[model samples]
Target: MVIVLDFGGQYNQLIARRVRECNVYCEVLPYTTSLDRIREIAPKGIIFTGGPASVYAPDAPSIDPGIFSLGIPVLGICYGCQLMTYLLGGTVSKAPVREYGRTEITVSDSSNLFKEVTTNTICWMSHTDYIEKPAAGFTVVASSDSCPIAAIENTERNLYGVQFHPEVVHTPEGTKMLHNFLYRVCNCNGDWVMSSFAEEAVANLKAKIGDKKVLCALSGGVDSSVAAVMISKAVGKQLTCIFVDHGLLRKNEGDEVEEIFTKQFDVNFVRVNAQQRFYDKLAGVCEPEQKRKIIGEEFIRVFEEEAKKIGTVDFLVQGTIYPDVIESGLGKSAVIKSHHNVGGLPDYVDFKEIIEPLRNLFKDEVRKVGLELGIPEKLVFRQPFPGPGLAIRIIGDVTPEKIAILQDADYIYREEIAKAGLDRSIGQYFAVLTNLRSVGVMGDERTYDYTIALRAVTTTDFMTAEFAELPWELLGRISNRIVNEVKHVNRICYDITGKPPATIEWE
Candidate 1:
């Protein structure tokens, strides 16, 4: 196990993901964690993450000096490196020429930290302070043009530090460096696999909800489906899944959900076709927040009614994953259209207890769990669909026709992505049905129609995302298909904006 002490780096979770990629379990903790608590986990290695603060500041965060004496293999990154140097009687001074982007680093002694690193390597540097002097036991391993102590290590103490961020993909050898740390330094067995996770999760669920009826709100997405399947395996007939189709689904999605849940998984599912109820509740609702609130309240009411009809349901099972819990209530607004059901949940709900089987997993890890649980690949790796369904996809009004148009456009976008064989590579790909309509020439005649924007992104976490680089030929093919096949869509465009200024979804 690898333990990362988070000093408030934005990429702290990225480090954890890299460690997990090497089949090693890792967790991130605040820098304020005590040495005694650290020892309790008995981690094989420790990583210190970068932060915004300079180590020379008067009120900067400082860890206990005793942490180094624990004899665990330690790797410090960026600001973490400066903190280690300053704590060990070294000097760190603010430099006038701060580096914030790419820098050239030359290997000094070919230390263990840079075992396979080339003589000249490109590194991602983001630091304003420099390590002016090294501690007594540490030696300079690598150096950049601007910073003298680019990397340092004390093999005897099993400590290593790098001034650049190796966890980021911008650094070419980032993944390789992380692999070296996990395999060479920590000597991990590399045995954490999906099958083991599934087994453990099943055991935990059975133990937690022994003889208790669990009611899961199935949203027909991969996460909810996988959670429902796992719960069924835990307590055979004691689980009941309620799938609410709130009049906001894509074309024929409610029937698909009913057919799949009842026919494939064979779980005891209650199909609540509350389309008219949802439409009636959402009459004259133009604001996004109001729509979300109305849908949320309706969902809870539907679930409560289903739970009562099914007799005593003790546990309210949810498919709330890690990112959903992190984004909400942290004062962080949704950067993308968050996987719904988890995002826009109502406050008013009465249930015995809540059970979230996939709470600790990420989006990718949830797919792995689904694969382990024998879910079909098509359903497991399907592009994420929002819980609000086509309601969010329709830019302005929530009408059946608007949803139909958006669904047709979205279907074309997804079909093209899969046809290009980029579905697995791309993190998320969706179509945004813009509210504005423009005039166009069709068949040498002037006509007015709606425009559809295609968006695809590649990201490990949806928090920060960049537009995916789709091949030009594939883009052209998709645009042609959307305009020719989908009615009322005369123009097609691609979304080139990242997470900050533009979200993945228009709504």
Candidate 2:
């Protein structure tokens, strides 16, 4: 197994994803993990993830210097590289020009670290400091125009460092670089796969929750669904899944999820209809982040009340994935969106422990695990829905009338997409109920109704998404059906905004 020391970089989990993509088992641990724990895991190699801090910062994270002397191969990335250099008697200083995007690098040495690396290659660099010179026993492997010491290596000790990120998609050869390090330097057998993950996860779950009652918060999303199935398999009837339908879900989603959990799966499933409770709490709330926080806190309260009715549960299982954990700034990443599941557990919960089975896996990886756990393909590959449900999709105050209109429109859009055999092609496609209205003449009559926005994005990893170029005919069909069938929405417009400029959801 390989271990990644996370230093709070955004791509820290991506490094684990790439390593798993190579069929090499790996997990990311905190940077402050002691050397004793590193020796206990006995990983084939160690990867230090990039961080958003300079090595010289007063409170910057640092690893024990004894890690390098353990005879295990070590690869340090952006901030990791600088930390390694600073600890090994090398110099790293602030660069005159900060590098943020793609840059060209020329390979000076071609053997160990740069096996298939071309002489001139493009790399993704995001750093404010650069190594002025290599550490005492290291040799410079590659250099770029903006940064002099782009890559450094010490063959004798099997230590390597790179100033650029090889995990992000910005670098074309990023995966290849990581592959070389995995196979050539670390000597990993490439033995890890989803099947192996399932076997280990089941075993770990059994060990963790031995005959203890565990209640899972199933949201029917890939993450929660996979977690529910996994825990059920581990401790049969000891696991109970309580799905909270808080009125903000998509059209008929509550009933659909209930049918599956109750009829399809053998796990003990409880469907709680708390729609009125959410409606009362979110009556006047309009701010997006505030809506998320309130929904998160309310979900916990509902779950605790249900647990009390069902006796006592020792653990609370959540489908908190790696992206949610990282983006919640659990490992020092900047707060992107305050995912409702990550940090909103109230202090008054009955469960003493929170078990997140898929915490280390990404979205795509979660789907893979879901399939491995024998879950239905349709449910496993379902489009990712936020924990806040349609609450975040609505621009302003949420109402039952607005929800019914949006639900019909969204259902029409999804049904048409499936009919066109484009359900799997588009990564995520949904309809948003914009709280704006436009006046239009329909059959010689002036109609002023709410406008609906259609958003479709085509992406592999959801980190960076591009707007899907849906055919004009399909868009016209969706628009016509919503306007003709749905009463409140008379106008529809396709959102052509990319993820960088505009998030997937408008609210």
Candidate 3:
């Protein structure tokens, strides 16, 4: 097992995900974790995640210097690298030229971390402070244009640090570097797999929820489906899955979800058609965060109502994955968006406790667990959908009219992608109902209507993503069909911006 210490970096979870990709089990704990706790876990390796802080700052996050003396291999990235240098009597100061985004670095072939990696390769760098000097006995192994000491290592002590991130995909060979650290340095056997995780999770759930009634928030999405099945496997009839059909889902999604769960699953399934309840609460709520919070709270209220009917439910389950938790401001990471299942929950929930079975797993990892649980591939690979549904997809207030329009347009967009045989390739694709309305000439008639924005991204971890470069011919077809078939949408535009500039969801 490997452990990642979070230093308030946005990519803390991403680092954990990368480690897990090496077929090693990893967990992220706060930097404030005590040395005793570290010794308890006895992790095979320790990783310090990069953060948005200067090591010299008065309030900068720090760790126990004793961590290095523990003899466990440690690898630090970016701020983590600077933190290691600073705590060990090395100089860490503001860089003459702050490096951000992709940068080329030269590495010595002797370092274990860069074992099979190219000597001169690109890496993802995002740091304002640079390690100016290495601590005593530490040798500089890598250098970049602006940063002289880009990578440092004390081979005898099993300590390594890099100014650039090897977790993000922008680094290209970053995975290979991580693989070297895990196998060559840490001596991990790569024995961890999804089947083992599923077995352990089921055993743990059964032990914790024995004879206790559990309620599951089943959205019929891959995450929720996997969570519900795992719970049912643990506690058969004791589990009840409550799916709230808030009017925000894609076209025909509500009915589709109901049909699948009721027919296929063995556990008790309840479908609450709370469309009007959600729409009423969301009336005039134009703010994205507000819409998410209202939907999240309403979902709880609906579940609470159902729980009362079924006596008492000791635990509530959500299908929230790693991306949802991190994007909702985990640790020091900025809140890019408030996912309905994560940050949008109410202050008080009626249930005794909330459980997220797939909390630490990534999107792809969840799919793997789903397959291990024997879930249908078609259901496991369903297009990723947010809990707030189409409300966030619509840029402004969500009315039944706007929902209908957006749903039809989004359905057409998805259908076209599937018809083009790009469904399995694209990670996520959907349509957004932008608030902008433009004047257009349709069949020689002057008309002013809403604009439809289409979004498609390809990603493995869902932490970082790139815009899918769709064929222009296919775009023309989707646009033509939406403009002609979906009413009230005259203008159709494809989102060309990537994740940094724009999220997959417009809101």
Candidate 4:
């Protein structure tokens, strides 16, 4: 496994993700991590993540120089690279012209790290400083116009550094460089599999919760259900899943979650119909973030209430995956969004011990593990939804009137997408209801009601995404179904914009 040392770089998690893509597990640690702790892990390889810091900064982060002499293979990225040079007796100062985005670099001297990588390569560069001179015994292997010392290496010490990021797609062959480091430099065997991870996670969970009961905050989504299943396998009836049916869920979703968990899986499951309770707290909320905050708080209140009824429980399991944690701003990263499981933990909650089985895994990894554990494909592949549920989908204030209209329209859109066999193709597709109302003629009656918008996108990572190029006929079918079946919705529109200018959700 590889260890990624974070130095406040935004793309730090991406580095860990790329290593995992090479079938090697990697954990992100803060740059301030004590050297003794790192030695305990004794990782197969160490990766230094890029950051928004200058080596010349008076108070910039630094690690012990002895780390280079520890004999562990090291790969340093942009900020990480500069930090390496400054700490290892090399000169690093601000560049006259900062290199950012895509830039071309030429391989000056050959090294095992660049094996099979092109002599001339387009790399994603994002740094303000450049290395004036590399450390002692380190040779310049790659160079570019703006950043002459683009790549530096010391093969004898098993250390390498690159000025550009290879984790992003802009650097097409970046993953290859990491593979070379993992296999050649580090002599690592790629043996990390989700099945093995599941087995180990279950064992750990059981040992942690022996004889004590565990309750999961089940949201009926893949992440939560997978966590619930794994815990059930480990502690059987010792785990009780509480599915909170807040008023904001999609059409018939409450009933579906109950049936699937209670009748089919049959592990101690409890369904709470707290729709009115949630709605009461969420009344008059109009702002998007405010609504999310209120819903998240209400959810915890429900969970705390459930735990009190269930008696003694050691842990409260949440369905928090990697995206949720990264989005909520963890480990030298900015907060893109606050997930209920991440930031919504109010001061008052029943269980202090939180167990997140899928915290390290991505969305795709969770789905794979779910299928590997024999979970039905339908449940595993269900469209990703937020813990706040439909509250976020409603553009304005959420009410029974808005919820009913959006639910029917959303149902129609999903049904059409599935019928077209585009359910699995589109990354995340959903319907949004606005306070907007448009004029339309229905059987010679002039109707001015709600306007519904459809959104669909394809994404490798939720970080960057592109709008799905859905056919016009498919859109027409969805539009027609919504207009005909769902009253109070007269106009339908499709979101053609992608993640750059617009996020997937309207709010």
Best by lDDT: 3
Q: What lDDT does candidate 1 reach at residue 223?
A: 84
* Candidate 1: segments with Cα more than 4 A from true spot: 108-110, 325-350, 440-447, 469-473
- Give candidate 2's whole-model lDDT: 0.86
Q: List the residue pairs that clash in candidate 2.
A: none
Q: How many clashes does the backbone of model 3 have?
A: 0
TM-score, per-candidate, Cα-based:
0.91, 0.90, 0.88, 0.93
Q: Clashes in each model (backbone N, CA, C under 3 Å)?
A: 0, 0, 0, 0
Residue 287 miss distance in model 3 (angstroms) = 5.7
Give the worst 10-residue stretch by lDDT in candidate 1.
328-337
lDDT of 1 by residue, 138-246 (tens): 9998887788889999989988899999998789988888888888888888987778989999999999999977878888888888889888878867888888888
| Candidate 4 Cα deviation (angstroms), residue 102 | 1.5
Predictions: Cα RMSD each = 3.1, 2.8, 3.1, 2.4
Best by TM-score: 4
Model 1 error, position 316 (Å): 2.3
Reference-based TM-score, model 3: 0.88
Q: 389-463 in candidate 3: lDDT tens per residue?
A: 899999888899999999999999999998999999998899999999999999999999999988899987665
Better of 2 and 3 by lDDT: 3
Where does candidate 3 clash, by residue pair?
none
Off by over 4 Å in 2: 56-60, 146-148, 280-294, 328-346, 420-422, 425-427, 458-465
